[model samples]
Target: MKKIETIHAVGHVLCHDVTQIIKDKTKGPVFRKGHIVTEEDIPVLLSVGKDHLYVWEKNENMLHENEAAEILFDLCRSEGMKGSEIKEGKIEVIADRDGLLKIDRKKLFAVNSLSEMMIASRHGDFPVKKGDKIAGTRIIPLVIEKEKMERAKEAAEGGPIFRILPFHKKKTAIVTTGNEVFYGRIKDTFGPVVKEKIAEYPTEFLGQTLVDDQKEHIQEAILHYIDEGAELVLCTGGMSVDPDDCTPGAIAGTGAQVITYGAPVLPGAMLLLAYYEKDGKKIPIVGLPGCVMYAKRTVFDLVLPRLMADDPVTFEELAALGEGGLCLNCGVCTFPNCGFGKGVVY
Candidate 1:
């Protein structure tokens, strides 16, 4: 840092804040630290009693905080995301559209391990709305070594550390499997509940199909939906281990690759996920447990956004949810805002 006359400080970066004093109106920083001195700022500085200023000396080997913040932003920005304007040595990553947020945990950890820099973000694999602040980045010091930033770039070599997969419109069908409903013994409450939940996404409901708890009947209904160009098929009820439960077997009978018939999460432990590939397109077929029919927030809430965004859920990823999968079932539910299924932090 070097001392220079306020008049000559134009284009230089201030090393410290310049405070202003008013008799009764205000007394605060007139110019914050790291502010670049401009010709128009000279008069304001002099009025604030700053005859001279301490400014950071320009160096070819070093990057100013704002410059370093841009580099960090570059490492995290991806489609469906935008960076906030640099301010106070910081930049925020904001969602440009509603989508599912995905982060490369390993690469994020590697970059954050570097000295004098940081990147803080919301948990990945969750829903994010447009204009939401997803992540923030900045440099700790006023200036950072250029070499260090280069290493950060290398750490995030493959692609941006953060991504937002926009939701895709899908033609969806629901098959409610239960003899109680098919035989008109009970109201078809589950189908209505499933429809209400899926209504929040960009899906075209292809109407509900009622099937008795018979493996062949269930299989026929599921195949019928797929043949109708349904991109997603949901089977509600008949997911338990009871002898009459036939939804799981019916889904497998359709020759779909069942990813998992069980999960570590409660209220959804009996959930089944499978995919049927035909003509190069993989259609998802999910068997939802009874809990989703009545519970305020279940495993369905955690996985629905990813599915709607066309992001496939892997077995390993589902296994990681065991840590924070149990929902408190609060009287007033605040799902994604709460930590119901955000356990596996890398």
Candidate 2:
């Protein structure tokens, strides 16, 4: 840092804040630290009693906080994201569209581990709306060593650390499997609940098929829907381990690769996920447990957004959810905003 006359400080970065005092109205920083001195700012500095200013000395080996912030922004910006204008050595990553947010946790951790720089973000693997603030980046010092920023870049080498996967419109079909519903013994309440939940996404409902608990009947209905150009199929009921519960077997009989039949999550532990491959296309098929029909939030809520974005869920990822799988079932039910499914995988 070097001292320079306020008049000659134009185009230089302020090393410290210049406070302004008013008789009774206000007394605060007229110019914050890291503010670039401009010709228009000179009069304000003078009125604030700053005859001279301490400014950061320009150096090739050191980077101003704003410059370092740009570097951090580059590490996070992706196709569906935008960066806020730099201010006070900080830049914010914002979503350009509604989608599922994915974060490379390992790389995010490594870069933040580097002292003097930080990238704070919302939880990953969840839905984010347009214009949402996804993350923020900044450096601790007024200026940082250029070499340290280079290491940060290397730590996040593969690509941007954050990405938004936009939801895709899907032609979806529902298979309601239960003898009581098929035989008109009980009201089909589950189908209505599933429809309401899926309505949050872009979907074209292809009608619901009611089937008895017979494995062959359930399998036939699933195949019929796929043959009818359904991009996604949801089967409700018969997910338990009872002798008559044959939804899981029916889904397996359809030749879809089952990702997982059970999760470590409450109200959704019996969930089944699978994908059917045909003509170079993979269509998703899900078997939802009973809890999804009555519970305010369940494992289904945790995985639906990801599925809507066409992001695949793995067994390991589902296993990691065990840490935060138990929903408290709050009276207000603020999910995703709650800790129900926010366990750290790394």
Candidate 3:
């Protein structure tokens, strides 16, 4: 690549299709991709493309390919960099090993923040191993030399401290309980509601079972799900303290520790949570209140996120959900994301 001594700032960068490439006596010439052009190449470029060749003078702190790619990705996002006109200020770069380095719009391109640059240090496809740093990020000032930038990018590339997280689809299970539903009294409306909500996530049903309010029957059903490969077990109904409401007892009978029998939330406060190890693997069992069947939201809203997270639900964690656990049932319920309940992050 040939280095140019200086460049002329054409009034401004060109936009849209070529308006006109009129011939000029200056004999400016045009250079194609990979062409090493110096100051002497300017007049030649003018001749080939005619008088004006939409050219942008290089900046003293020009960003590298990967760095420029992050800027472009950020520019295209909803929270994109402000003041960057999509047409005039966009720069494109190829993706790296860890995919494209996307920059957040709120993150200003400060010299300090750009210290660590993610680069394609090694060559290969994905499925990179653990402890293998496919990409790295650091913050350095803009005063670094060009040769220094390459060295920094290279050093930051190999054995990076951080590795990209592998995307894992959320898995869930549904367990419906109630003598009325199990015995076909009310036609089991709760099962479908739970299914509808569970379907919204990238999860599988795993399996579901309908059992009477009998603690033994419900316990067997809960155990069956655990044996079948269900990490998250959601049991609807039989959650109240009424004599017939034995879902909580059944869940507890499964030898799982109940997190909380009651919560500060309304409509679904009569919730129950239990966890136990069967064959060395932990299983989560939830006794959903009757309100979950008809109410808009409740404790299930709080428990759902924890199940989807990489960690298991604990009594202390479930206990903290009471703060935002209450359900208002406002005129318009934009649940999960609204301020109504604890707001489960799907």
- Candidate of highest lDDT: 2
lDDT of all predictions, in order shown?
A: 0.90, 0.92, 0.52
Write model 1 residue lDDT over 168-193, tens digit each, in one string. Answer: 99999999999899999999999888
Which ranges in model 3 have alpha carbons more than 4 Å from their true place? Answer: 1-173, 342-346
Candidate 3 lDDT:
0.52
Which ranges in model 2 have alpha carbons more than 4 Å from their true place? 3-12, 20-24, 33-53
TM-score of each: 0.91, 0.92, 0.51
Q: lDDT at 10 for candidate 1?
A: 91
| Per-residue alpha-carbon lDDT of candidate 2 for residues 29-131, written as tens digits (9 for 90 to 100) | 8888878998999998998789999899989999888888898999999998999988768999999999999999989999989989999999999999999
**What TM-score would candidate 3 get against the native?**
0.51
**For model 1, what is the alpha-carbon lDDT of residue 217?**
97
Give the better candidate number (2 or 3) by lDDT: 2
Candidate 1 segments whose C-alpha is farther than 4 A from its true place: 1-12, 19-28, 34-53
Cα RMSD, each candidate: 2.7, 2.6, 10.7
Best by TM-score: 2
Model 1: which residue pairs collide? none
Clashes of 2: 0
